[model samples]
Target: MKYSIRKLALAGVALTLVAAACGDDGGSSTKAGGTTTVATSTGSGTGSSTTVKNTASDTGVTETTIKVAIHGADLSGLVKAGAIKGVPEDASVGNSRRIQYYLDQWNAAGGINGRKFESVQITWDPADPKSYQTSCQKIIDAKVFMVLSAGGGFPPDSTPCITVDGKTQYMGIDAVSAKQFKDQLGNFIGLAPPGSASAKAGMEILAKDATLKTAKVAVLRSDWDFANEAFTEVDKVAKAAGINFVYSDAIKVANLPTADANKNVALTVEKVKASGATSVISMLNFTNFTVFPTEATKAGLTLKYNILEISSGMCTSFSAGQLPPEMNGASCVTHWNNFRLDNTGAKATDTPFEAQCRKDFEATYAAVDSVGKGYPAITKTNPGVPYPGFKDGTGTQLDMDQSYYECNIMNVVKAGITGAGGNLTKKTFQEAIYKVGLFDVAGIAGGKGSLSANKLWLASNVQQVAVTVNPDGFKAGKDANGLYQGKCLSPLACFRTVPNTVTPLTFTLS
Candidate 1:
């Protein structure tokens, strides 16, 4: 289940694309007594105006620097303890390196308003819930103005320690509930679409699909706030579509120990089987893909799967042998476009920005490897090919997901700083980010990225894809670790985009 941590983090970042031209206030401004005051539009599409005062005394800001804390999960300890699986030993290192690379570049380019960014790197063990709060407290104690979480394992409960109590801006590249965002008082910014939007879109897709619409669906969700919010949206979509769910329940042991969580999932499988449901719509995280399918198979239950969130990792899990045979033909409604799929046409191709990001990452990794860091270097024969399934010399693939996420989030930070103008206060940063309208994002499909005061989420659209195993076997050779490398081969799979299923998210604040 701890594998869900990394998957959720990657899903949040990879699914989001935010870029836009900065809009103007068109009003006068003045500065006095260590305060900068400006008149700006409210950006609520209501033609309203307000005065915003940005003080130099704001926390974490000094004459020559703006302090930020970058938080990530150090899963190495858990992996070595045999408590977690399928996570790289250098996961935290990779994330920190990418973020630091961007910060260095920005600082070298004369950072926001001549104030260079000063970041404090922080890490926590995922197996320890107390560590999450400790990480948050560390950032608060550091007196950073902003907390930029690079990956998952930052529990929702710990977030308020920074955003609410500490009064700092929190930008997370992970999924969270719509309520969480609202409760933050405009302090929390998520890179991915909220769980409500993702769940609603999944149900909408099921309603529109000819075959899935008539199926008796069972809704399964975890007890997490984000999953519960998703379940609520699912219910709304089902009611509006005039579709009835055969069964619906939350896994009660979501926050419990592994044994209790497994027991809960097993019992849920029994209930789902008894409900006479032919399909299941999952509102949980990546754990659903790993645990639920295996449990269902054990009970001899055969159900069509439709996952609402973390679909990127879920789709690939089938190929990696992480999921049971019950998930062979599962479908996912997600913002991710699987570049490993064969028949995706232009969608599988990388944009110019994505290509450049890969080049930059490769160069960075090469530099690190030169210093005997033991990190995998980009060894792909073709520079144009996507790195989803490419195996490195260590038999592990370069984490393109993390790379893309780091790139996108850094771009968003830069945009926010640039849009904030000379007054780099939390208020100005939030307003600036909200006013940055649609722009091109590297990994996202064209015209699918936007942000506004009303629309805090970055992703604009979602697509459904089917996970299917490829018929052809592995390509010619093997990696240094004896793992086969190549295109979608036998045990390896592909997430083919379902035709005519691309849907835009309804940009409404719930």
Candidate 2:
């Protein structure tokens, strides 16, 4: 999950896997920097059914319809202005269409509890903070029961408008901190694991790795709240494992001018090199991650990179020539399944839900392309090819990401609604999520997920992977259309999940 942050030259923030928020235990627990109210119960759940009252008088719920809002950013203007390139003309429309495909399917099959979903699409400018507030106001004005933040765009600060003031149920695919989740009360549910959780899990995994365990490592992060929280968690984990960091610093000029931020990154690289660190664990977002490594290379510094999943879209950037060649072999600890591996025959296997998502996504895009909407179809030159993101070998990797997130998020909404039972309200939805526990999601760890009274985030496992360039093309070979069959684009890089490195994200609470 990568998104644009305020005043950053590039649009890249780490939007990791979605998970629920931390629950209140009526007692406070002290952490590295502060005290947090922790949940007494673990809040783990298995997907199970529980019956509640069938009568409904909830807000935004009528006898026959449940109004919801699909919130997204209209980035076509950015493309037109030449501020951003290589993106679709209208991403919001495509995203909404993809989500609507599922909603239409569900309604056709008879919606949950005799009520069909009626969704309204809300679009805003990503570069404008005022637009976020305005978009929240629009959703409030529409009086929708829930807002599905379909893709990355929403900021944490603007969330309280919808979840707190508007008193609406909100489920997003963006990353959120445990503190942010607690502030949202029970109205917010995120699709990715919290930053704190991912940091703890990623750091612990690196600590146990044979190569990194005793290596002098530098920890780098930005000044954003999520990034800061992640750094704190990493520090805690490193201390517990007795793994000391040779260098640790945060880039604090993110909100300053672009020149200042770049200068800061360069200075940090020099500091890391001076510290005699052999490896760096990057907790920065996608944009900063891009700059940091480039600066390191410029400073004649060589180091191994272990990146957190918060830098979600870095793999695609590396493949697309957006990142420096120095990042070719960086490693990541992530819960996200490598779509390139599954799409190509290199690792030819998909979880049941992943297969279904690919099928539906191809069908949806094929329809859109047939209408000459300019959106490329998921077409392969060969008939036997399973699912491809290119048409004539000229397409962006964002298509794959969009499809994955849309499918997973829609499924999450359905599962939550169905689990909530006949009588539906925000409270019932939250309770149902906790009660149902682990549910099925596509393209995540084994398609298993959960939200509980204690655990707010949903990721169950993480895997160690390294970015590798395929000197030889994909195993399937090139198609007649000149599209690389099994391999990615030239320089052919993709994240390969390491064998036997799949580990559950089990971290002890402080």
Candidate 3:
């Protein structure tokens, strides 16, 4: 059954996004004698005068300003040298820039519930696990109202930790991570693929496809604790769906550049073939994904693979014709529509919502050059063309996801403030979030946003897609040139949602 938060809440259960027996301990409060500055609106609406206040008692929230922090890999430097993998470096940098854009726009449009939004920037090395802890600690010290750790996929700072209380605490690590983060930091939100549920969704798709219905399936994912947890949950659902799970192996590889990376890929492929598995479910990065088929081809092995498409990690690479032909019919489990370059026609018939979204995308894309070269395809060629590049443009699903993540958080912040009314404390703000449950953000991948009362996460809504090779070559979907033509971008694909529901707390924690 699809777990509905409204149903549960209506039933009188006080469950939070993270089901815990503990109460908020105010662990994120500022240290004694430490002071933080907050921005607030002195008046109301767009013309309201903004004011800043520095006080010891008030950590993040103030009369005029609400302070937050964003932690992620040093994308600004990485994208400039063309060193980042998976999504384009421009997209990575664009994600951060998009966050800033959202804040500025919100302030311009009267700000969040009359108070402006501000953020502390902390860019850590992606490969350094300690950086995450240090960054979160910094946010805690700063007493930001919320923390958005916008790593490409998964929190770079999250890992299993033994708390001072001697309990096994997972902060931003797994299902319990959000709670742990909230316990240590203030309010927090993140965008991570519901891997196991998505895997089950993919299995349902396979069950319907004649070619893969009875194929011997193998599960391949990173050997991280979180990935393992996802694999375990998926294994249960796949078995329930009558999937022939012939093999399961976790790839214990890091996303860094190392000699063992290629070796690990070769070894993983060997394991898959030796198990006689005909199909694979991969929950790894795009770089590792490309390595899988490449190694398979070199070994003369034939196989089909399905991968998780989230965080703009897989779509851009795939849509850019980066995959091999042998993997033509490979499937992807995604919650959002993949982005395609569009240059069709310019029309104003789109709903105000869409035009606004596209406008936001343009604003962010235009500013990409402010940090560095921006996207090589976009700004480097035709400058100031709203949608730049080969008209490859900036309004793809990847860009939208960044906007969605931040905007949704902003929505929560606004809702919390409005709900709190005259008394907007951290506790009241949280209460406001729960009171204003099931928010539908204007433009998400699925067109509808689902949030639970009091929960800081979105319910899993996944769909499966099979790569439809385009013999006519990938065409940039026509941008608004007066009329829009064609459906879906080049490298055509077909998708069907799996008739499945993942209940909250459904995945096993152990």
* Highest TM-score against the true fold, candidate: 1
Residue-level lDDT tens digits of model 3 in 89-195: 43435456646776787789866555677877755554444454454444445556555544344342242211211111111212223333344332333333344
By lDDT rank, best first, the candidates go 2, 1, 3
- Weakest ten-residue segment in model 1 by summed lDDT: 14-23
- TM-score versus the correct structure, for each prediction: 0.78, 0.76, 0.67
Which of candidates 1 and 2 is the stronger one according to lDDT? 2
lDDT tens readout by residue for model 1, 1-510: 011234233433221111112213222234332222344656875555334343243467654577888888776765675444545665676567667777888788876556688999888765565566567657667878777776444656457666776667887766566776676766777656777787887778878766666889888777776777778878998888877799987787444544455567767888898999998877654543357777787788888887777322333332233445566577777765533343343234557767666666655555434212464454432322222224543444533332355666676778887667555666668787777766556544233477776666667787777765433324444334322243332234445567667788884565
**Candidate 2 residue-wise lDDT, 425-501, digit = tens:** 67667887888778777656555877776666566777776765454443444555433533443324456566666
TM-score of 3: 0.67
Which candidate has the top score in lDDT?
2
TM-score, candidate 2, is 0.76
Better of 1 and 2 by TM-score: 1
Task: Assess the local accuracy of residue 421 in candidate 2 as a C-alpha lDDT between 0 and 100.
Answer: 55
